[model samples]
Target: MVKLIGDLIKDVIEPGFCLGCNACVAACPMQCIKKEENEIPVLKTGCINCGICYGQCPQVVDPKTLQKAIFGDNPTDELLGTYTQALAVEAKDAIMKAHGQDGGAVTALLSSLLDDGYIDGAVVVGTGEAPWQPVARVATTTGELIECAGSKYTRTPLFIGLRDAVNLYYRKRVAIVGTPCNIVASWRMQFSEPTNRHLGETIRLRVGLFCGGVFRYKEFLKDIIERQLRAPLAEVAKFDMKDGRFVIYLRHKPKRELALSAVKRYIDLPCKICSDFTAEFADISVGSAGSPHGRSTVLIRTPTGAEAFDVAKKFRKFSAVELEKVKPGIEGVRLEAKAKKGAAAKELEIMRRQKKPLPVWLQERPPEPPKETIESLKSISRV
Candidate 1:
């Protein structure tokens, strides 16, 4: 049963453990893992066996909920305080603010690292006339970094920078900021290529954002058009994860509004299979929802992340608040996530327990990524 999580972690680090959560299907390097009824995780058995899922699972998957698991009862160190939206401020009160959600704490953190010469560059996302464009960018300055703000909840591949970082790793280090899936991909790449001496050694930091959820690129956009506004899915240029709600402003004759409930119903087949809400492989993971403005909520997962952030704090880039205690409400979200996954997994084990006929939903593949970008929609975010 993999009773000990440490055992699971070790097995996963080497040969691997499934924990029965099916994130592997969506993020598979080989496009494996299929969904059965209700969209649960099912190892295709035909899987090419790429290990993306092993590294991405919440570093600790308690299976009970989607909430972050605090294994130790250690006092909550106020690495940074919680914020809503009011606390935001600029970088130098810098140029990045123009691009970020609010004042741009994220930009500030990345910019600080760059300005101090700590990192040679920042791996970030920027928008293009299409979805693929927002997937990658190597930001080296405040202006270049901020241009890629707003919530981009689609799945992106961070390994896109793997080659570039390796090429430039000699003189400077690189810090990567991304969602859970992207972070795990990069982390694995580093372990595999660590001694590259140039790129692997140069990639120094991983910053993960607390994830509310990630949707399939096409399905998410489709929901906004069909269910919510009953309008054309004009374009979804910019998005944000704020206040426990996924806020996406749509563009229609007048503008259109979409709610999370309708979107949740349409989550992609891949998301339904895997269940890590926080990017567990990152060095430091950030989240909003309960975190207010001006203040950023940070989870210091690695000693390196803690040290790097401490260095930034010394520069007065921003101030931080230490939670006397983490609110149960905040933890509740994760718990719910974990529970949802558990119920689904138990069902998988039950039906498959017999090695008999298991529920199955198969599809003929060979589909291309959607050519869905409408040039006209790009204007919505700019205006």
Candidate 2:
């Protein structure tokens, strides 16, 4: 029998494997799944049990299957995944360079795509009503995109923003900016059984950010930043993870730094099991891992990513240094990726030894029925 939302909740969410990407909420045809702020999706009444929600979940879907669907080959690179080229990029836009988290390459690239009419809008994470809280929204212009720049250490359900961009805003073509989990969720929506192919068709570009992990907002911002450090969240200018420390910049005040070890316990539970460090399935993967202080490491993984990057470069939106020229180069990114994968593997082994429930992706199971077979069965059942 096929698994449903209840199974998803018991196996993934209860086991603390849900990535909170909101793909299931977006792909639900009956609108039964509701995505709560910083919470796993809740299934309301009227679920048809079509299995789309279970299939679209990033935690449940196998990464290797999605990789083959998106990249057309089994990736041999263990650390960084398959990619065409790597570069260190610094945004040429002064505002983006100054305000963006690192090099602002993602902001610059999105701006270029919007200005050139390559994409109708982009799904991005912006500041919410509460200070430093991440909220996902659609950016249709460069100004809006710029406002959405910078990193939020907290997780948001970005795929909901993609749904609104296409379904509500009527954007025909959209770009999605997210972390590795979000990218996996996108691919799951695109290729999973009982697919929401129409929704996936609007996603023209996938730009993934490098992530170490995300923290719970209340824990990290409230307990650590506000209470412990005595720094007001409203006065905060930016957040950065650098040199093994979590750095906080405040307005008109001296910045404060906390060793990553100090806040390690605040990291969200779902992040511990994640292995993808560089968003291997994205069109283009970007992060600060392999670049200098004011630059981002860009990995063009597919032709779509290469084309977009080339167009942005031809317009001089950013300056780039080939991977070979950058100090430490891909080695820096490789080391981090390797470490993350190693840690996740160790954790999974421990969980297995404990007989803990694992996500479907990590479980040994027979292949799911194809979409055609599922449709035929549905037809027969209705008869």
Best by TM-score: 2
Clashing pairs in 2: none
lDDT of 2 by residue, 1-383 (tens): 66788888887777778767788898889999997756578888999888888877878766666654556567858788999899999998899998789999999999889888888899999988999888889999889988999998887888889889988999988999999989888766665666676777688889998888898788778887899889999999999986578999999899998898778778776677778889898889999988988999999998788877877776688899897798779999999899889878887788889998777667776475465643442232121
Q: Which stretches of candidate 2 lie over 4 Å from their true place?
A: 366-383
Global Cα RMSD, each model: 12.8, 4.8
Residue-by-residue lDDT tens digits, candidate 1, 1-383: 11222332343422222222233333444545554432234555454334544433433333222112111122232212112112222344645544566446677887778777777788776655654233556777777877776566665544444444444433367887876655544433333211122333456787777665565555555445545556443454446655435555554344444466556655543344444454555667666533445344566665566666767765676555542233433454345446445644564465467553322221122122122321211121111
lDDT of 1: 0.48
Each candidate structure's TM-score, on Cα atoms with residue i matched to residue i, is 0.60, 0.92
